[model samples]
Every structure is written in structure tokens, then in C-alpha cells.
Target: MTRNVGGIDRAARIVAGAALILLALTGAIGAWGWIGVLLLATGLLSVCPAYLPFGFSTCKAK
Candidate 1:
């Protein structure tokens, strides 16, 4: 898939994902927080399926 996630978006995802994961691990947000894995995956892959349906892209034009 194309790299549709831009630098800022990637960074935000990383931060948000990490925080959610940490919260889950600490029992602060319950198991649902583990869903952060999705964010982490999207950030790492530089693609978001949800964004696809809407034709959204955070990446700069190449």
C-alpha cells in the first residue's frame, strides 16, 4: 500500500499508540486500550485503511 501517513501523523500515532498501550498494561484503560495496536500498525505501515474509504492522505505529494 502507499505511504499515506505523513511525518506529523506518524509521530502522533506513535505517541498515542504508546500511551494507550501503556495505559492498558497498567490497567488504567482496561483491555480496550490494547486497541492501540491498530494505531501502531498504521503508523508503522504508513497506511490507514479507514482513511482509504474517504480518500484521505496525510502524506506529502511525491
Candidate 2:
């Protein structure tokens, strides 16, 4: 993975993912919160499969 996620985007993903997972554990958002795992994984890994189709990159030019 070439780090398609960066800067604020990465931070947001981590935060959102953590929150969703927490909520799910607390029985607040139901099974849908499980999707947060995807966000967390993508954020930590700095890659997103969905972005592949659009050839998108949030990472800064190196």
C-alpha cells in the first residue's frame, strides 16, 4: 500500500473508527458499528481499497 490516507484524513478515520467500535461494544449503534473496523484498519494501514477505483490519494506528494 502506498499510503493513500494522510494528514487530517488519517486522524479522522482513527478517531471515528475507535468511537464506532466503542459504541458498538456498548450496545449503542448495533452491528453496523462493526464497519468501523474497516475504517480503523484503513487508517492505520494508510490505504483504502475503495479509493483504488477513483485513483485517489490523500497523501502529500513525495
Candidate 3:
């Protein structure tokens, strides 16, 4: 898959994902926080399926 996520976006996703997961593990948030896994996965993979529908991409044009 093409990388539609850029550096900043990836970093933000990783941070938010980690925070949500931590909160969920600590029982600070609802189980829904587990959805953070999707963020983490997208960030690491640099591919956002949601962006494809809109033809959006954060990566710099090569």
C-alpha cells in the first residue's frame, strides 16, 4: 500500500494511540479506547485506508 501518512501525522497518531491504549489499560477510559490500535497500525504502516476514499495524503509528493 502507498504511504499516505507523513512524519508529523505519523507521530501524532502514534502518540495519541499510545495515550489511548495506556488509558484503556489503566481503566481510565472505556474499552473503546482500544480502537487506538487502528491509529497505531496506520501510523506505523504509513498507510491510511480512510484517506484513500477522499484521495487524501499527507506524504510529500515524490
2 or 3, greater by TM-score: 3
lDDT of 1 by residue, 1-62 (tens): 87789999998998899899999999998999998999998988899999998889999988
Model 1, CA-based lDDT: 0.92
Which of the two, 1 or 2, has more TM-score?
Answer: 2
**In candidate 3, what are the lDDT values of residues 1-62, reduced to their tens digit?**
88899999999999999999998999999898999999999999999999999999999999
Off by over 4 Å in 2: none
TM-score against truth, every candidate = 0.92, 0.94, 0.95
TM-score of 3: 0.95
Model 1 is weakest, by summed lDDT over 10 consecutive residues, at 1-10
Judge candidate 2 against the unseen true structure and give its global Cα lDDT, from 0 to 1: 0.92
Clashing pairs in 1: none
Clash pairs detected, candidate 3: none
